[model samples]
Target: MYDWTQDKAVRVLTRLASEGLQTDQIVDDIISHVDDFRYEAQMPTFYFLSGLTGNKKVASKVASLLQR
Candidate 1:
């Protein structure tokens, strides 16, 4: 069984980013959830944050989080 909740979050975040919505806060929220105990939750958050590496607004924050 899979946790759809995490998938839903990732999908929503991706959609929001694709639409040029409030991406900074979206990235920040994703970064904050990177340490989630659930692999389902953590991996998607990490992947999403990783995909934002080229985004200037949140790149440093994502890089800092990735370095930890």
Candidate 2:
């Protein structure tokens, strides 16, 4: 499930970016989850990468998913 979690994290991060989430805030959030055994803490960081593409609503939805 590592790859899946990593992919999910990347997808969410892309969504967050489209939603206009600040880069620093996103970075901080991701970093904070480094030790998290839940929700693949790195997902937010993956989304923050420059090349990832996603929509604002999608990002928000991803964010909601992580919150769950």
**Predictions in order: lDDT:** 0.66, 0.53
lDDT of 1 by residue, 1-68 (tens): 56758867786786687567887778667656655637667666656655654776456655675687
Kindly list the per-residue Cα lDDT of model 2 for residues 48-67, writing each as its tens digit: 54343543433554566569
Off by over 4 Å in 2: 1-6, 14-21, 38-68
TM-score of 2: 0.34
The TM-scores, one per candidate, come to 0.59, 0.34
- Alpha-carbon deviation at 15 in model 1, angstroms: 2.0
For candidate 1, list the clashing residue pairs, or say none: none
Compare the candidates by TM-score and give the number of the best one: 1
State the local distance difference test value for candidate 2: 0.53
